[model samples]
Target: MIWIDTLAQGILLGGLYALFAAGLSLVFGIMRLVNLAHGDFIVMAAYLILLLVTLMGLSPFVAAIIAAPVMFGIGWGLQKHLLNRTLGNDILPPLLVTFGLSIALQNALLEGFSADSQRLPTGAISTASIDLGVLTVGVLPLLTFGSAIAVIVGLNQLFYRTELGRAFRATSDDATTASLMGIRPGNIFAIATAIAMLVVTLAALYLGMRSNFDPNIGPARLIYAFQAVIIGGLGSLWGTLAGGIIIGLAQTVGAAVNPEWQILAGHVAFLIVLLVRPRGLFPRAVD
Candidate 1:
């Protein structure tokens, strides 16, 4: 009974981690640019949510709806104007640029919102829970997990179905060749990033409502997201979800034994996965 409950809860928790990593994975898989500021962007979106809720008295869902498109534009413009310039044959330039962006974001958030931790006000929905036959689940967590699946499925559809997605894969395959084919690699990257930011906005809603977050917290989330993507193997949404579940299950089972083992367990699982499958549980053949 205990194990069953643990597995169920961990699976749900993985959904949240998947949400955190989806945007990161999307950008990385498509452009190979690791947005070091991803966590901070999540934090930024949270602040946007906070403002909307507090000032406009809107529900968190509505706030997310409003913020996602705006975040998308920010992401698109940022990539077009800034990150595209940093990209090259060598990955180091983009890494350095994103790292600097991370620092800048943290400082900017600090200046604007101070160091105080904040949470989105979600009313009673934040506190609500559902009782299953064997266990219980929080509504917010369930919703986060559901959203993660929806995002993954949606991304899969987009990747396999749309012309833009075809361009994205082609761009990911060979930017030079893609450009020669009249696929503007820079524009593709910008659009990919914009979509990623939309995912980030969704992640932010759950993140802020589920826990109190400050600007300093994004890096940690970024770490978890990185692990999940690596463990799942890059470029596979289902793999990412599996990776998150593995980490989540490890953490929860560890916590059942010792309070502090939660995070340590997840890391241990990540290390084990790396040891056994260096390329990840699921990876592209050539990529």
Candidate 2:
């Protein structure tokens, strides 16, 4: 029963990790642009939500509703004006650019918010849990996991069923040819990033609610996201979820044995997965 509970909690925890990686996976799938600042962007959205809540007394959910569109615009403009120029046959440019952006964002956040940790208020939901015969589960964790699944399902539908998704796939397959077909690769890239940032806003909502966050923590979050993405296979949303579960399960099981091993266990799992399948468990065909 103890182990069952631990596994259940880990799976729930994986939902948050999946949220963290989903946007990163989406942008990479469409544009092949690795936004090194992805985690910082998540933090930025959290701050946005906090600001809205603090100023307007809005609930976290409502604040997120306001923040998502704002973030989408930021993403659209950033991709159109800055990141688009960095895309090419050479991958180093995007990496260097996003790395610089990451540094800039961290310093900016530190200057604004300081090093103090912050969390979104959830009232009773923070402590609320459901009792199962064999195990109990927190309402917050269940909500987070549900959100992750919804996001994945929504994204899959968007990628496969929508006209914009068709544009995304075409651009991804061959940008020059996509351009020749009268599709604006630049516009598609911008929209893709905007969509990614919208997802970031969703991720931020869960992240800020789930745990205390500080300006300096973005890089560590990025590490988890990167691991999840790599573990699931780059550009695969469902794979990303599985990777998150793997890490989450490893950490929970490790902590069961020895609390000190929790973080190390997740890293070890990632390394083991890499060793076994260098391309990841469900790598995209192009990858």
The TM-score measured for candidate 2 stands at: 0.98
How would you encode candidate 2's per-residue C-alpha lDDT over 1-287 as one tens digit per residue?
A: 88899999999999989999998999999888889999999999999999999999999999999999999999999999999999998999999999999999999999999899999987899899999888999999999999999999999999899988888999999999999999999999999999999989999999999899988888878888889999999878999999989988998899999999999999999999999999999998476
Model 1 regions more than 4 Å off? none
Q: What is the lDDT of residue 189 in candidate 1?
A: 97
Best by lDDT: 2
lDDT of 1 by residue, 1-287 (tens): 88888888788889888988999999988988899899889999999988898889999899999999999999999999999999888988888888898899988999999999888888899889999888888898899888999999999999999999999999999999999999999899999999999999999999988889998998888888898999999889888988888888888888888988999999999999999999999996346
Report residue 225 deviation for candidate 2 (angstroms): 1.0
Would you estimate the TM-scores of all the predictions? Answer: 0.96, 0.98
lDDT of each: 0.90, 0.93
Candidate RMSDs in order: 1.3, 1.0
Clash counts for all predictions: 0, 0
